[model samples]
Every structure is written in C-alpha cells, then in structure tokens.
Target: MNAQAPHATGRQALFANLLFWGMLLVGGGALAACMLVPAWLDYQAARQAAWAAHARNDALARRITAQQLQIAHHQRDPQYNERFIRQEFRIPTPGVQVVTVEADPTGIVAPADDAERAHRPAEPVFPAKALATARRSPLLAVFVLDQTRPAVMALAGALLTGALCLISGPRRS
Candidate 1:
C-alpha cells in the first residue's frame, strides 16, 4: 500500500487567511505611506514657497518705506531741488569750469578759451507740488493688494488624491 502523511488539518484555510491578511497589511501600509509622504512633501514645499513670498513682500514694503523716506528728505532739502531741476530740464551746472584742450597734429598747442564759458544760463525753479503728487501715488488704493494669503490648498488636495489612487487597487468596471 502506498502511504502518505495526512495533510495538516485546516492548513489550506490557514494559508488562505494568512495570504489575505498579509496582502491587506502590505496594501494598507503602502496606501498609508503613499498618502502620508506626498502630503508631507507638499506641505514642506508649500511652506517654503510661502516663506519666499513673505520675504518678497517684506522686501517690497521696505523698498516703499525707503522711497517714502527719500521723498521726505527731498521735501526738506533745496539741493534736491537743484538736482531735480537738472534731471527734469537737462540743464548743466553753472559756475562749474570745464576745460578742453585741442592738440594739433603738427605739434602746435592750442590754449582753451574761457571767454566761451564766461556767460552761464540761469537756473529755473520747478513746481514741488508735482513731485509731491507723484510720490503720493503709492498711498492710493490701486497700488496695494491683500497678499497676506495665497492659494496653496488646491495643491495639497491634488497630491493627496493622486497618492490615494496610487496606493489603492484599480476599481472594477
């Protein structure tokens, strides 16, 4: 008689159950990781982006503040008036001597003439109110916006959804 050892009782059932539980554990772990990792990464990226935006906003604010200070200083100084006049009118400074010497190819020296520069144009005054008005444009409502918050939640939700799909099995048709 051919003899064989009897199969262990309930071994097939045990194996099936073990396999199902193992698959569940592994699948669940993968799903959880897929969800968690991207969320974490997205959160980090969003945080960094927000910080960068905040830095940019702060820099712009500081620049605006500095410009305001400059305007205030100019209002108190008359030299700024002269400078602005020079810029606005393209006028050269009076009483400042500019000497130019011409050299002859034949080794002859030509002396610079002071007579041509003896007479200088008078400087004109500019309206300060225009400059003040230009400086005040920043205080207008059109120049500002509410940048204290930005839209980043959509990015987080999208990442979470993509991760969930990746970890979960495909749906049956």
Candidate 2:
C-alpha cells in the first residue's frame, strides 16, 4: 500500500500539469476568437458602408455638374428664357400660339415625345472601381469560426476545459 501511494501521487502530479497547459491553450484560444472575430466583422461592415457612401457622393457630384452646365446653357439661350417665362406666368407672346393639353382624370400622362426621351440622360451604372475595391478586401480563414455565437463559444470553452480536467483525474493536494 505504501509503494502504491507514491505511484498514485506521481500520477496526480502528471495530470495536474496536463490540465494546466490544456486550460491555458483552450481558454486563450476561446477568448481571442470571441473578442476579435466580431470586432473584425463589424469593422469590415463599416468600411463597406463608407465605400458605398463615397461612390454615391461621386455620382451626385457628377449629376450636379451636369445640372450646372445645363443651367449655364439655358442662361445663354433667349428662346429658353422666353419659354420659361411663358410657361410660369401663362402669358402669351405676340404672334406666338400656345396649345394646352388637358391631362386625363386617371392622371397618367400620354407617352412622352420621342424627341424628349432622346434628350434625357441614362441612369448611371455602379462604378467598376468600387466593385473592384470591395472584391479586394482580405478574407479571413477564421471567419468561419465567427458564425458561432459568443455565448456558445464560451460554453464550448467551458465544456472543453471541464472535459480535459476530468480526463486528468482528481487533484492530489
């Protein structure tokens, strides 16, 4: 029995060391995954939002510049000025005829004139540069781990720690 006692003590010491190291690795890994992964995902989302806003700003700037050019052109044209005044004030110019078209009660306008449609600008396409920029964002291999809830991650860590400790058997001292 006395000889067996020393063997039991030795086994306990070995298990205690194993438990300490296992807890260290498992606990550290879990802590890092729980905190860092979510923060990284959030940062990625914010960056994408900012890039979209920048692209929208560029599109609006181009539209505004186009509008300014149209205004300048209008200001230089006597015909446009006369038309504007007549349209706004409903005043008739001498020797000029104005035809009024009444809208249907259902409120849908008749098809626009082909000439009017031809002069309208096309809708802008999404910028290729923005798409390329988004595509170039770095993808993390650990992102798969992010899908698990933080609480679940914590629970898994606890379970693993408990399992390892159990495998190491009871503490001696």
Top-lDDT candidate index: 2
Model 1 lDDT per residue over 63-172, tens place: 77999999999999999998899869978778776567877679865664533332333222122322333246543211111221111233334444554544463532
Give the lDDT of residue 68 in candidate 2: 100
- Give candidate 2 regions above 4 Å deviation: 1-15, 92-150, 156-173
Best by TM-score: 2
Clash pairs detected, candidate 1: none
Clashes of 2: 0
lDDT of each: 0.51, 0.65
Q: Candidate 1, 117: how far from true, in Å?
A: 45
Q: What TM-score against the true fold does each predicted structure earn?
A: 0.46, 0.54
Error of 2 at 45 (Å): 0.8
Q: Give the deviation of candidate 1 from the true structure as CA RMSD.
A: 21.1
